[model samples]
Target: MPVANRIPILCLGLLLATTSCERPAPPTTAEASDSYNLAAYIEQQQERLQAEKPMVLKSVTTEEKPTETIQTAEIDWEDELSVFAETDLNRPALQEYYTREERVLPDGNIVLEYNRVEDAEPLVHYLRLEMTPDRVLRQLNALIQDQNILFYSRRNIQLTADPSSGNISGYRVQGVQKLVLSDSLHYQIDANL
Candidate 1:
């Protein structure tokens, strides 16, 4: 064939190949709506789900019961104060002149006894100073109010009046004194009135 005729034939083949490779058209909105019914499709899906067996959940009941309950008793303030006063008066004073031996209970109650010199009633009078629960607590609080003071002083921990007892009798005292150390250790003293 002539070159001009061959060129036209090749052009025609290329045009046919390109035209044959067209993509399918997208579905129209009406066609898509007809294909899937929203309500009926959901109902059909629900029916299929309902036809399957359901998972069983067991509810467990506990059989264990609590064992014990704690109960506390009320304290007697008058008897407590009387006992403290007697104990303090009976304690023996230290050997040194005008010195007294003081004993502190685990609860911070204090007992002191002093020796009396001949004709020196001053020591006895001084020892007779009245102590009220509030007074004791106030004095103790003053000593331990500051952390610095508490750490430095060995005598920082002291008894305070018990708030519960103090209300019944203004003179009743009960409380604990805790001396905290730098290393987080604590020395506890307790007293009650």
Candidate 2:
């Protein structure tokens, strides 16, 4: 039990303990092969995705064909005149006023031959009545009031007058007026009166 001898034994025990402990072995090539397989699988997926990519799209072209033109023959003047004459004669006012046979010419003209006293009177009255600009405008306004017509234009009155004379000689008016019956349907009146 000498102190120097005990010290030598303790040093020998520490040397043996440190030298006996062994380090763990490195992974085998099989583990490395597994990691390599995973990388290969990812590369394969990427290659598949690239292969399935869509191609560049292109626009389609269509063939053009020449269009055909159609020509119609002109109608006869006598026929046109007759149609207009018939239309005028059939009007409610004219029918009520005239008790005569109306004839139509080829040039879209009407010739009225009165057969009764009433018819003659109306014809004379129409011929004698003056259709001045002011009179015409007054008549138009009366008609609008009588018919209960409403104008759709933003302005109350859509008319133009002569600057120098201060008279409505010639003008054009266009607007929508409400009808009596249904709310949906409206009358579109456009005229130069």
Candidate 3:
């Protein structure tokens, strides 16, 4: 053939090769069996890995134990005066002045001792309360003693705490306290606490 005819034939062959370039067909049975074996081996390995791994804490606890429960109180009822009396449990919040102690007497009664600092003044408050371990209020002896720095006229105090609630049910405090700043003096203060 002529060179012009050969160039046209070469262009047509190049165009066909570019448009319909194809690879050899893969072997069907061998390839499919190999892929299926690999997938099954991977799934088996995953199952073994899951079986070897330890169970989570939440799952183990849920299976073996109940959900949750609150325990009973361990301390004596007298010792829980701060909680029952509606007082602050954190001692540092009260400038570390308040203290509580519990003791068992020979008569099977509990003695609750409290030493609290007067927030309003510089005086100290001392209290000794006697009660039963099962929340029975017997008696309370309180002393709101005076400090020489300020003029305080105190007569008498009568207080009664509720057995169940551990709070003051009937209270009578009679005293006249004057702050250091002003000249105005406060008179008798008798109120139910």
Q: Pick the candidate with the highest TM-score.
A: 3
Instruction: Rate residue 117 of model 2 by lDDT.
Output: 38
Q: Please give the ranking of all candidate structures by lDDT, highest first, separated by commas.
A: 3, 1, 2
**Against the true structure, what is every candidate's RMSD?**
40.8, 45.9, 34.5
The per-model lDDT (C-alpha) reads: 0.33, 0.30, 0.44
TM-score of predicted structure 2: 0.16
- As for candidate 3, its clashing pairs are none
- Which residue pairs come into collision in candidate 2? 77-106, 78-106, 81-108
- Candidate 3 per-residue lDDT, tens place, 1-193, comes to 8998899899999999987766434335442222112123224433543444322111111223444322322323232222123222222333356566778899887776667745644233665667767636655555564656655543234445556654443433444455566453333222222
TM-score of 1: 0.18
List candidate 1 segments past 4 Å from native: 1-73, 76-89, 93-169, 172-176, 182-193
Residue-wise C-alpha lDDT for candidate 2, range 1-193, written one tens digit per residue:
9998999899999989887775434335442222212123224423543454322122212124332222222323233122112222222333345444334446433333333235233322221111222222111111111132542211111223333333332222222344455442222222221
- State the lDDT of candidate 1 residue by residue for 1-193, as single tens digits: 8898899899999999998886434344452322212223224323433444223221222124332222223323233233233223221221222444455556554444344445443322223222332223222211212134464322222223334332211122222333555343333323322
Model 2 segments more than 4 A misplaced: 1-156, 177-183, 188-193
